[model samples]
Target: MNNPKFEIFKAKNGEFYFRFKAGNGKIIIISEGYVGKPSCVNGIDSVKRNAPNDNRYERTDKTDDYRFNLKAENGQVIARSSEGYTTKVNRENAIDVVKKEAPNAPTEDQTV
Candidate 1:
């Protein structure tokens, strides 16, 4: 869909997931899991514009040389994995992070 609120993607293991901003700069997960590609695609909006919004998550917040270590509001380290890794394990890590933040999302329902 073209909705800016959320996007569904298939993980490398052929599992699917719904992801979106939790309004408070958080990310929420709506689906259990469905692996599609070998990994997750960067947000299309940020990619097409060549200006990856700071609000949206990106592999390299600083530059290509460095990767991101996804962190939660309470200082809990979520997914230290980067988008550069397209392995199933990496995709799973991303999902785990999304799930952790999803429950506390202000704009989305907690899947529990």
Candidate 2:
């Protein structure tokens, strides 16, 4: 992916979505899945930012009950809540986690 970067946005559903760009702008946009948790849009986070519910990654469009987790360059997590619902941890909580996990996170724009 060219010109890859972290982009955060709110979908029409009011749910949050983060996009991780690569060298060509190619990226993965992960959202909340059936497991009732958030996921990361980028690839790095898939490891460090695991779902609190099960610490797994899901790939499906049939349900927004799963999740995607992204990792900051510093090693923090950036997870997105499932659409149509919010997690008990909340965005702020995710942000705190990201801060803790990725202290020198270069992708601060992609908050967990």
For TM-score, the strongest prediction is: 2
lDDT for each of the candidates?
0.38, 0.39
Tell me the TM-score of each prediction against the true structure.
0.25, 0.32
User: What would the per-residue lDDT of candidate 2 be over residues 14-49, giving only the tens digit for each residue?
Assistant: 565654443344343343422212443343244334
Q: What tens digits encode model 1's per-residue C-alpha lDDT throughout 1-112?
A: 2222444555566564555553344443333443442222222222222212223333443323334443433443333332344454454455444444433333222222
Residue 104 deviation, candidate 1, in Å? 1.1
Off by over 4 Å in 2: 33-112
Please report, as a residue range, the 10-residue window in candidate 2 with the lowest summed lDDT: 28-37
- How many clashes in candidate 2? 22
Candidate 2: deviation at residue 93, Å?
Answer: 32
